[model samples]
Target: MTSNSLFDNTETAFKLKSDSELERAYFLFKMISKEPLVKIGTAVTKFALNINLPVEGLIRSTVFDHFCGGVNEKDCMSTVDKLFDAGVASVLDFSVEGKEEDEQFDSTAEKVIELTKFAKNKEAMPFSVFKPTGFGRFKIWQKITENQHLTDAEKLEWKRIEDRYDLVSKEAHDSNIRLLIDGEESWMQDAADSLCEKMMEKYNTERPIVFNTLQCYRWDRLEYLKELHQRAKNKGYKLGFKIVRGAYMEKENERAAEKGYKTPICESKKATDDNFNEIMKYIMDNLNDIELFIGTHNESSNYLAMDLMKEKGISRSDDRVWFGQLFGMSDHITFNLGAEGYNVAKYIPFGPVKDVMPYLIRRAEENTSVAGQTSRELTLLKKEKERRKL
Candidate 1:
């Protein structure tokens, strides 16, 4: 291999300096970028794997080392403290799976409430994050959101969802722990966004204690953000939104094409990027109306927002905005921003091994779905290995 320095010409970054860490990212990039459909099938199977495989051990050592906090709450905090020491905050996520049973729903709610209590006094754990599906069933949400009539039990189930969030949000409100709800599949998103807006109305009276995530991959979301911002202004309440380009790109397109509907997703990557940056500017321009979370892995996009902020004379420490990347993928952005005195956090997910497999598989596939060069990580590994040799 040529003597290519991975860190060359790069301003400061918090990436692997050791050969071992570099090697792990290189291999993980391959695993995650496996053909999309095949990877999902494999992920579902592996997610259900009861028999241990060699790959699982590789996982514990590689991407898991980079991404997940741990299998338990306390175990998760090791990274929290580490990032906190480096001036970064952590989001406490239970990483609960989407389940249909009432018991599971109740358990997830209790866990989040307990997590909120634990995070209340912690300076590093700034937000309590969870998926709505983690606390309810997807099919029911689909039905309710589609305006289809529901059975009495189905209606009752929806009520339970409201009640569960009420409990969790009440704790967050009383304890002053910020709550963030993750976005999900396009089919069930109407319910998720509506429920989140309701929570925003309920708890966001005094401040942005609850935030709804907006996935900008969809063409409509830019318009959606404008509407949301207007609603926040009209209601005289602060809006909290975490903006992401989105994760389910392929799935969203395939489903729409299969169903013979106009795809809700942007027609091209450029369109999505265009919308994402536009929404970023709109939010940054109206900082007093909203608290924005820049949740993304794209370096150009991160710098675009930051540059815009600087142009507008927005302080890096302005509590109105935040920067976030998943725990594992882009320490380059997360740690560097932290070092620059920006409010940054990693979305730290923690749960039992079985429950976190889906998240892990997505992490694996995400590394693959992008540009195939994969050369950056490869270069990093080779350099670190070379550095160690010298």
Candidate 2:
């Protein structure tokens, strides 16, 4: 049996962080713990950026440096090397959001392809990730999800989107790097899911080179997983999934209310947790045809995954399973798992400061809204600080 106190070891967790870095983490989490301060801070930062004020340096030095690896692939190498030194891998995430142009979509797709090539032959980076909306217009995805008729121009636009997906998937397959396609809001997710399924069918013949994100906050994800599994099995293709409780909870709930439709989200936090665990268990049960990437900051869920691996007698360094957390947050969980010799990776988001603000703001808000997340981070940081003193 794995020790229940495994994650309580702050020494292993913070060994890579210097005293100044630890203090900055403590201060950041302390500020994020205050909901009001986060709200005010987010607004002020957005406004300052909107006016093109001189806050990029300030933002980059604080939250940007803390949360992100750096502004580009070249800049992120130092952070990736540090993580690999601690036996953790990095997934370089280009986190620029909300682009609506075809050229921008092409650029984003090219970036993913470039990152895949960059990760080639590098043991430190086994994966690359991109958001669906980053490669196509959101309205096109929503229209396809809603099954509405599209104009010829829209058809051409969507064809380009498919080409982008194919381009990236092929690159990942050839480069031998796993690619994760992130989940988006429910209204547009159906189309994204369809596209990802197509990619998996084409590229996952030998192994899982492409992964689809499953936001388990949605009550239907377990059923979706089962259906997808059946389809993959029938077609004799592998499957890969990265499961998270989800982002965009408030946006999802608000949209359901506005549209007068049943909310897709689970009824409560407990329900979401159960759904996540149930889906995770399903993936664990079928590791032969399906690979698993468990992306979560929840300690209990991490423990459950570890326990399941133990029960199944899977090796600690199995290539078919990986545990992932974001770069700045969840150091305790990531580092502890790494110490135990589990396959661990950190999703290291990087982009220009202005372009990556949406991603960073969402992270801060998520830390504030997820009950006890900020406090847990604070407690661990404090414990590490005290340990250093002793």
Q: What C-alpha lDDT values do all the predictions have?
A: 0.79, 0.95
Clashing pairs in 2: none
Clashing pairs in 1: 32-364, 32-365, 33-368
Q: Write the per-residue lDDT of candidate 2 for residues 279-360, one digit (tens) a residue.
A: 9999999999899999999999999999999999989999999999999998999999998999999999999999999999
Structural RMSD, model 1: 3.9
Candidate 2 lDDT (Cα, whole model)?
Answer: 0.95
